[model samples]
Structure formats: structure tokens, C-alpha cells
Target: MTGEDILYPPRASAFSWRIFKTGEIHTVSVGRRKFSADFQLVFRLIKGLIFLTFISILVTMIALPHMTIQDIVVCILAFMPTGWGMLQIAQALKPLVRRAGFWGSVKTLARGYEIVMGLLLFTPVAFLAWFPFVSEFQTRMLFNQAFSRGLQISRILGGQRKGRSSRNKE
Candidate 1:
């Protein structure tokens, strides 16, 4: 056995098997090592839930002539976690933002622009919300692209690429 293998025995590899809480700090155990982070796994799940809620609400709003009081309340509640998750994700990415230098600053500014646009949607000036909304939406899409690019780079650097399937290769 390699010295590294002796130092760290093989452990469960599936991150999906674990449950994480939203409020508190927790440790993720990997073989003999542990990691702690400000944003827990639960927030990631919450973010996904938020996205689903958004799509559902949009569809429902479009389908219905008018929304009931209950529908409004539910929509508000569903949207709360989206704002929370966005803040948490931004907080979690602070270190990476610092490490990325100039491009990071641009991303940070884009995030700020998104927040500003979100706030503008609530103001009397919201008549122009469409303009800012497009900018905010584009910023988010680009930011997501950058994040995925970073992940791909990290995977390549770490030697963890899964080879293409036969169909994909062809």
C-alpha cells in the first residue's frame, strides 16, 4: 500500500448519502480528514428548491387569471430561501473572489448589480425593471459559466476527468 493510503483509509465516496443542516456548522468526514465550511450542503439543496419554486410560481402565475391571498403568501415564503441562499453562496465565494483578482472583482461587481436590480424590482422605478432584469439575468448566466469553467479547470488540475462515453467520443 502507498504511504498515503496507509495514512488515509478508503471511505464512503457518495456525498449524496449524507444529510446536512441549514443553520449550524458541521464537519464533513472523508476517510481520516474533516472539512468545515460556512455554507453547508443543505443550502445547496435549498438553492435548488428555490429554483423549482421560482419556475412553479412563474407557471402558476401565468396560468391563473388572479392569485389568491394564500397563493401570494406561499409565493413569498418560497422566495425567501432564494435570497438567503444567494447571500450564503456569495459569502462562501468570498475567498475565491479574493484569489481571482481582477476577474473576481468583476464578478463581485456583477453580483452587486444583480442585488441592485433585485431591489429595483420593488421600487416605484420598477417600471424599468425589464432593463435591469435583463442585465441581472445575463450577469448570472455569465457568472455561472465562469464558475463551471473554474470547476472544470480544477477537475483537470486534480486529474479527475471522467472520459467521454462511446457515443460522445464518436
Candidate 2:
């Protein structure tokens, strides 16, 4: 391999849908580079905490009789991405199940359970996304990393332009 290749490895790329400000959804390429183990752990921990928080809020909204329609709608919008993310974790773990030993067999059963749960979780969201705005919002939430990366690139380019402008004025 060349020195440049060794120094700067190629980033992983995946295709995902992105929602534009004008309410158009389009499939776009996104980076999927590996994160540090520590970062992964912390990110998973934070995600779990956020999921729990949303679940609690949802339960409260259901249990209270004084909930407004707006509150219900807001809760649903917030909860979809949280639930989708958790199900995604379950889907990710399915392939890791082993089936050779007793524990492996147990894990296989657990994997089956996870698959069932993932289907259950996905069904409602799949239906909900049939609506245009809901689908746009869901896509925006799920592919947020792509949007953030775009913003970062813009900021860097903007800074470079400003630097050139200042140098030209000097």
C-alpha cells in the first residue's frame, strides 16, 4: 500500500435516505466509518438513557387523562426515532447469535425473540411513514449524521473562503 493509503484509510460508506428542507426525500451516500470502542460504548449508553426517557414520557402521556392532542402528537414524533434506533440495535445483534453449544442455542432462541420484537417495532413506524411529512421527519432524524457532516464541511469551506478574502484585502 502507498504511504498515503496507510496514513489515511478510506472511510466506510452506506446509502441512506435524506430529507431536504423542501420536503423531498432522496437516497444519498453517507459515511459509516468505525468509531472508537469507548465512543461506541458511551453513545450506546446515552441512547439507552434517551430511550428510557422517551418511554417514560410516553407512558405518562397515556396514563394522564388531561393530555392534549398536541402533546400526544409531539410524544409520537419524538418516540418514533427512539424506538426505531432501539430496534436497529436488536437487528444488528441478530447475526452474532451462536447455535452450537447449550448457551449458543439459548442465544439462538433469544435471537429469534429479537427478530420478532424488531418486526413488532418496525410495523407501526412503517405504517406511520406512509404519511408524507412523517416520512420526511423520520428520514431527517435517522440520517442526522449526514446532515451534521454536511454542515461541518460547509463551515470549513466558509472559513477557508473568509481566510482567502482577508488575505486578498491585506
**Residue ranges of candidate 1 with Cα displaced over 4 Å:** 1-66, 95-170
Question: What's the C-alpha lDDT at position 148 in model 2?
Answer: 74
Clashing residue pairs, candidate 2? none
Off by over 4 Å in 2: 1-101, 138-160, 168-170
The Cα local distance difference test for each model comes to 0.47, 0.49
Model 1 clash count equals: 0
| lDDT (Cα, tens digit) per residue for candidate 2, span 70-129 | 645654455445445544564566555223212333334346446767898998888887
lDDT of 1 by residue, 31-144 (tens): 112222545566565556656755674465535534455654554454445545644675677777457533333344346557766885667455555687867876778788
TM-score (all chains, Cα) for each model:
0.21, 0.26
What TM-score, to 2 decimals, does candidate 1 have? 0.21
- Shift of residue 121 alpha carbon in model 2, Å: 1.9
